[model samples]
Target: MTKTPPGLPLRDYAALGDGRTVALVAPNGRVDWLPLPNLDSVPVFARILDEETGGSVELVPREAYESSRRYVEKTNVLETTFTTASGVARVTDAMVTGVAGRLPWAEFARRVDGLEGSVEFTWRISPGTMLGTRSPWLDRVGEHTIIRCGQLSMAVVGSDHGPASSDPTSADPAELHGHFATTAGSRHLLVLTATEGEPLRVPDPAKVDEGIDRTIDSWLTWSDEFSYEGPWSEQVQRSALALKLLIHSPTGAIAAAATTSLPENPAGGKNWDYRFAWIRDLAYTAHSLTWFGLREETHAAISWLLRTIREQGPDVLVMYSLGGSTCAGVVEYDVPGWRGIGPVVTGNPAQGQLQLGIYGDLIAISRTYVDDGNLLDVETARLLAKVADKVCDEWRSRDAGMWELEDEQHYTSSKMGCWQALTDAIALADGAHINGDVARWRAERDRIHDWTDEHCWSEDLASYVMHPGSDRLDASVLLHAPSGFDRGERMSSTIDALTRELGAGHLLYRYSGVADEEHTFVACAFWRVSALACVGRHDEAVAAMGALVTQTNDVGLLAETVAAGDGAFWGNLPQGLSHLALINAALMIKDLAPKEAHDDQ
Candidate 1:
């Protein structure tokens, strides 16, 4: 066995996928984390989540070699090149695609082609079913192969999960017969489709080929909708693709990330599972999706979210599983932590927190929907009314803020949310919505705004404090600009205070240095960027935005936070909130860019 680098090394994984599922490809050519059928489902290949029992599918060059990898231009197709003493070999990985309504199927595909000289490689495939609970029983069936285990039966061809060896000829199975040479130019393919206990259908190779072509075409076609013309176009585009990969296609809900329990800090107890969808996250996602002209995704996320909130009643939970199921109870998994981040946990404790700001996020989304010509039904209106009433009754009550901290307090941002929810609700009633207490809402809205100004603002700190009677400054309040709460002199002052107190190098901490050594909140920085753009600080905002993009991994993937000292990625990776904030900040800055610049070129 090759000795892994110390500190539970991840082997430098990158993701590739169709819209449905993602595969995390490791540096040594092993696919470590893959959740089939859906993003939130139990992993079918989960070595990253559990290094011992969790299985993986690997492709390794037969000789000693160096390797480098990148995603293909403007697409999710991953290309990894392995260079041996003789020459280089490139392996491309992608998941096969299907139409929106196509059910009961999905694909994982790989193509290996030589670049220069004869290079040999080996392949090892071991699939862990349902979060490593079972291993598939593979049996050869003519040209095709079958993996039967429990409720899932899959037919695969072109590759087999055999024994592990760096040599190509170590263990030969019928399904494992792809050869690589300098001039041979061999083509090999492996696809796994979920049959879901139904009779398995053996399709022809030509159909599979067509599916691959159509999948590539769909991604290329969908990517054209992005209208960003920015300095880091490639990084922005890859961020968009990673966001798409994290989205659950069946319901159009974007997951927070592909894998969970990936740790906020390697040794810190900040590990969180982000596969669930939060109301705040969904709203941010919808805002970005709409700006990108993906109305379908926007509408789907909004509709699903609204229906889910309706089912869960007018009160919104902090988050929900991808299927809108509220069964996420945080449990520590019986496995080693990622990169030695102990206590790999599932479920989020924040799900049960009394986050009063969720109502504001919901109302913000609904207001945006109305702005986009989508009419609000009576049910949504009634739900908004209940939320507004709750805000009116409890704006001053102690509860967790947007950060989901354990210590409930009269969070200033939560107070701002009260103002936002009522403000948007009143706007909704004035439009085509049903009857609501517009006068009462307005009265309460103004009251909450005044209360925030009186109690939340601190003269000594020269910014809005984290909570009432506290001098601690929170970076979250920087969202006041996007929330339309404060602008002009007050906004400028708050921005200056935040820059002075919370800023470290280029990264912004969630609060002052006193807040438990928190990781530099990546999304909060983006929020600062958006707020700066809103306040007409275009040059600084663009520079900050550019710096934020630089913090991304080589593939333009971001974690929930980036360590300030060395700028290493930390926290949950490929974070949806970070991407969502990026999309909004990009648009906000674009809108603020001088029109003369548009006319100049």
Candidate 2:
């Protein structure tokens, strides 16, 4: 087996998903990170983290090769072409989707077709167990090979020559392997099916080939529904597709990202598990989906989010597991982190932290739903009103800011978020969606506005500070401009201040003091684009939007963060918030463009 080169940039991987789970495929033809059976499931292949112990499925050329890859138009199917000295070949990878909804079985298929002279190809599957809970053993069941680890079982069925020799007792065990020489017009297919409870029947190779077409058709059909016809339309559609891959089909709970434990700062210690749902992320995603007229996905996500809020009641946590349960405590693994950044962790500890900003997220989602001509159900309306009341009561309290900072304060953005929540609640009440104390909400909302103006803004800094008594600038405040917090001179000046302080070209960090520590947050940069458009900085917004979209990988996927120096992606893959921000910013740019420019398109 070929050793994976150390320190592979996070941007080098492309993602594939069936709206259930995702797989990250590196440019070198390795399936580096995949959580089989479910998005939150323990990874069956996690070479993205610990390359030694964590397993991977590789399909690489024997000879030295140069590679290029792209997603098939209007779909998540990845086509990577390898050009070696002898010949060229293309590998198409996808997580097979069912005709209607998600398939009952988790399926990943790869097809290689030769386009030139004969090229030698090698492939292998290395099964891994989760956190050492169970031992994985390969058993040859009739004509197929089954890798079983605890409750999860994966059946490997494909067209290949045979298994290659490998050490059976090693930490990195290869369960199956094969090699073959292919010339022009040659075709090969590999399908991996996984199930949680029971073993899967070995699938026919021909049927797996058919499943590939069906999956492609499913993605194209979904993409066809997108109504965007504006500037950056292609990038917007790709971002929308990336966001769709993060949605859990059965539950409508979209994960923040696909992979977890990829550090925001590669130097060490900022890694986070993003394979779960956050209220803020889901709200942003729902709002973005609504812009494209994707009512089914929007309603599904809102319904799931509302149900989660209703279950948690007045004291809703900041985030939840993908299944809508409370987040598990953080558990550090001995597995070496991506690029040896160490202390890879599962689960988030921020669930217990008080984040008053989520109230705004919830209310924003409800307002979007109501504005779309859909009335909230009785339970949802009541839950939203209860959340609005909680926001009113807790607007003055110090809590974690939108960046989830450890040092709690009366964050300027958080206070403004409360103001937004209360104002939205008054609007909803006026619309008669829920019975609420609108008079009290209005008074508290005004109070928040007054407090923010008095304490958060700093004449010395010439803009809104991070929080009361601090002069740090935060990119999060830019979000308020488009939300209608202040569209006049103050907000326009805030945009300029953020551009001067937090901005690194078109990208911006989350806040002050972390520029050298973490990568620039991609969502924060997109927020700047929206703020610029709102404040009539049309040329700047267009230029900034162009730069931000170019930061995406070749396949048009953005991560949570990008390196400040080289524009390399650092955090989790295909972040939901990043994609949502991209969509929103693109829409804003199109909406704010001059009539002649829009008509020309």
Candidate 3:
């Protein structure tokens, strides 16, 4: 019987999808999390949030077995090999997509193939409705089953996919439930789809097989557009796939992670839902997509941001729902958290905070567009002018830091963002996008920079402080190296001090001043790596990048942070900003590695 994967030090899970929806499959045969129809939809299977009560879809061989798995070439098709005393079995898993000119919002399919000797397999499909609050009642109709909960109706078609046997201890079932035995050269397919109108007729096995073949071909063709040929091409490609999976195809909204409240520190109250789109995520994603030459999705995401910012007004929330809906106040749930983390939250409360850094994020995106030869339209320019006016009016106000801390302070990072806004605004005006006082904007921009250098730096610490008069160092300053600030001896010394003080082996702490007991922020670590490379510290940068790559889960997916000692993952999994940082860091290392090593040689 397929036992729970040997409780080895299994790193976190990797993700795979067909661009429309995502599925988090464990190193074992269980699919831990998946939202139906789209990435932001209420989850249909949510075992990752609450392992015991929440539902999951498991496809396990009915034999004591060992297994290894990976994706099939350039596509997102997951292939696993199960080894048993009898023999071995290989199962290929994928959430099938439309093909042959079919509409994207169609059916989803998973296919299992048997290789080697005869292998018996079992599966369970318990539909979690109302986001794991209630399990749906199942009614068998003809050869199909209908699971109805509230307004959502899910249809499951196929035999040999159901609940586990009642042995309570039997690894192999005598009477199989949703169970089937396949010999050499045998194959099986399972299909799941949703319908709001009248129920559609279920397709036969022949049609399902055709769909599977077409879906595989479609993914292969789509992945061909990825032009990144780096030293670690496979890992980079996989990272790109993980980033793509979080994108909601219909609305162009990218979720922070597939699961929510996964916990920054296991058993801590740092858990927060990341299934919504943050403006910061959109800007970073735009930059990454521009680098990768995926302009269509990037433009769509930026347009989504523009619409959201327009509707939400200049006082934009930090984040919003996929369709631009406001996120309600966070609510605590009774679910047992990951590894016993407490206080799992359902939404993010940082939505309404007054963060001055967003102005810089918008300006950075606008600059990227203009640099890419894609002109910011007159309307976009006008909107940016409005944002700049706000920045000008509130440039001296104290607000939350980039970490979004509660106690308002004169955060150096926010001030730097204000500097970035004015600097980029001057460039936007040069493009004739708006009629603004360019001379005044330039003066204010330089003043902000001068103030940051004068007040935010500390002589004793020898690095930029988190805020004026604060002794703590923040990893966020590592970003200034790439922001094209004065990166001379002072900046280099500051980067080195940060490396020594906050670097937890490879992972870097977000800030040293705060009482935050969370994991080291993975993006900060990458930012430091990039800064090290840029400052001609190639040896340090290479070692840092090596250590960072080692922390990726078995399938090459990275969470927001890694535990300093235990190496357990912390924070949200497959963070977009983190992955974006990884790509940019790789680029920086590539450009600087040779120059520094040669200078020494």
lDDT of 1: 0.74
Instruction: Please give the lDDT score at residue 243 for candidate 1.
Output: 83
Candidate 1, residues 125-190, lDDT tens digits: the string is: 666644445556656567555665566666655432232222224322212223335434645454
lDDT of model 2, residue 332: 83
TM-score of each: 0.91, 0.96, 0.91
Best first by lDDT, ranked: 2, 1, 3
Q: Which has the higher TM-score value, candidate number 1 or candidate number 2?
A: 2
- To one decimal, what is the Cα RMSD in angstroms of model 1 from the true structure? 3.6
RMSD of each: 3.6, 2.3, 4.0
The reply for model 1, stretches above 4 Å from the true place, is 1-11, 99-103, 129-132, 135-145, 148-150, 159-184, 195-206, 514-518, 595-601
Error of 1 at 532 (Å): 1.3
lDDT of each structure?
0.74, 0.85, 0.73
Model 2, position 490, has a per-residue lDDT of: 85
User: Model 3 reaches what TM-score against the true structure?
Assistant: 0.91
**Candidate 3 lDDT tens digits, 1-601:** 9664222122546566766667777756877777665566556666677666555667787778888987777777777888877667777776766654333443556676667777777776655543446555655567555665545566656533444333325432211237777667777776666643345546565676676677678767767877776555676677777788777676777777766777786548788788888877778777877777887778888888887778877576788887778888887767766655666667787877778877888888888877888877666778888888778878789987677789889988888888888888888888876668778788888888899999999888788888998888888878877776646776788887887788777788888843257778888989988888878777788788877877777677788777788778776677777887888788787766675454653
Candidates 2 and 3 compared: the better one by TM-score is: 2
Where model 3 places Cα greater than 4 Å from the true spot, the runs are: 1-12, 100-108, 129-132, 159-177, 195-204, 513-516, 592-601
